[model samples]
Target: MAVEQNSLIENYSIVIVNVAVAVIHYQDQYLLGFRAASQHQGNRYEFVGGKIDAHETATQALIREVSEETGIDIANNIAVKLGRLHHDYGDKRVCLQVYRIEVTAQQYQQYKNLSQGLEGQKLTWVEKQKLLAGDYDLPAANKTILAWLQLPTQISITYPLEHFNNASNPMTVWVQYHQEHLQIGALVYIRIKETGTEESINQLLHLRNDIKAIIPYNFYTEKADNTVINRQIVARHLTQAQLMQCSNGIAKNDIPDFIIASSLPLVVSCHDKESIDAANQLAKACLKHQLAPVIGIFLAPVEYTQTHPDTSPLGWEAWSRLAELADIPVIGLGGLSPVMSDQAMLHGGVAVAGIRQFFK
Candidate 1:
């Protein structure tokens, strides 16, 4: 027993060993495995790993698991321990030891076939921004893993447009990224919300030439309308499939970028909690796509404080949390005046988004 223990701990000065894990990166995305539906925490994305086998070293376990799941074998010389995480799940406690592994293109290609359903699992490569956007449900343990793997890398393209007096005038823009010019196959989307006017919709459609596709919100019934509401009108009017195909066009390109989903707010009877939650969710989703920064027009209610004094303040907190979680800029919309712009950012926003303030 003493000799066996000495063998496991031979090279290590530290006596205690922790369960080890590995984070695999490909094209600025981390490889994650989806836990299939089971009695345990299934349907959540998790790092590919398992408990270290008895008498086996963490490095040995990592190499084995990587080979099992990804088919790409890591040279023992290349595997390096990045960090470790200690966390407690509801049912079980785990100490996840993490490593950083680098692989060559040839090795990746060779292992691609063997990388399927290792330990009977599904896998995916998710970009850091998408991971932060929180679209897919992740296990609690994986969240900690993600926070540690957050590398400082520029993975987004930003296009800043100069405002023109004539909406029809081609908007001069600067696309900022390491790449000089966008590839031919890159797809962009131009989206607009209905402001109860056909002219606005037409103006947005005209901008479609600059983008690969356009999506317009067309199905909205006024509260005063006693007639049956047609939800399908929005679906029918929008070219969703075309938009999706355009969005997917990036796969063929060496590097892909997108711009989609603009926002325009119309006056409604109430700014309820549900509406605020939905808006928060949408904002997070948009940031995940790294779409053009949204410009929202907040139509203030006639009697703002009377109906939603309590709820109005909560929106700031919700927006703050979303910004923190998603690490994306948000421009506050409702009741924002020039005087309040600075305060809004301090609370949690990029700038004020309102027709009166922004248009001027």
Candidate 2:
């Protein structure tokens, strides 16, 4: 009996890399599966997934799980890996690899007849509001996974307009350099000055042309009022002063869906708890206005930054705690670069954001 107990202990000691979960979204609703009463944590609701086999990759496991549990077969390249969650449940540890399953409108309609493919389990679609309201109970381990689902994988902020006078030559060189080395999908930000001379505007126009030549990528201006070329808007913080500044010229109705038929995400920055709280409140307000909620919340000063070395940082531990409270995806800014992307993701940041790293 002692030897058997030891064997069981050894089994638990080994890390479990078998499980994969899916954050299946159709429109604004998330597809969730209810567990059977006979299973562990029975009757509780969670994302649909199953254990991976030795021969299968993480993506393969998710494809199989979706088909087996939901009677839906996702096409290849439809699912994007969000990240992974490693949690210890006393008996065993699970590394839950999460993926975001995106489908076209027609493809989604084709799966309308999808049902609960597994016996003793049921399926339902929950809207974002209901899910955020905490109406449906979920396992504690899923708290982090839910947060990860809302995060952007990577983000790049460009230097302000002052950095380049001839936007074509330098900007073209910059794009070519990045394309050859690091092929990353990032939401690029082109920092435009609020008040610019006619020459600067023309230069920006030329720069915009240079960016568009790449095709199949997204870029936006930093200045809120410069909406002529600003495809997406970013509200730095929710302080009354900053909020008023960010919303000064823009109408309330012009947000969330500023551009029709495009997924424009609003990025908001937060430095401390007060701003984070205000950001959440602002998100709720946007929801009320039917505007897109804050998609990225950047918490800064995780480490002492070269930009602001005098200011004390929140450090990694505190930043992680605050990140978990954010209702939207949070990115770690200040003293971070693309090299720290994995560390940022591990410590609750959806992506690593920096001004000097990517810009300089």
Q: Choose the strongest candidate by lDDT.
A: 2
lDDT of each: 0.41, 0.58
lDDT of 2: 0.58
lDDT of 2 at 314: 90
Model 1 lDDT, residue 39, Cα: 32
lDDT of 2 by residue, 1-360 (tens): 000111123355575544777888886778888877887767788988878776677667778888877767774635544444545566666666666676567767876555564654778778867876677788755655553454455555544444454667655444444433322434454333334333343344444433311111123334555554443232322323354444423344343233223334356667777766656555545544444445566678898977567989998889987876665567787788778877776666667866666632
What are the runs in model 1 whose C-alpha is more than 4 Å off?
A: 1-18, 111-115, 153-360
lDDT of 1: 0.41
**Model 2 residue 255 CA deviation in Å:** 11
Query: Model 1 reaches what TM-score against the true structure?
Result: 0.37
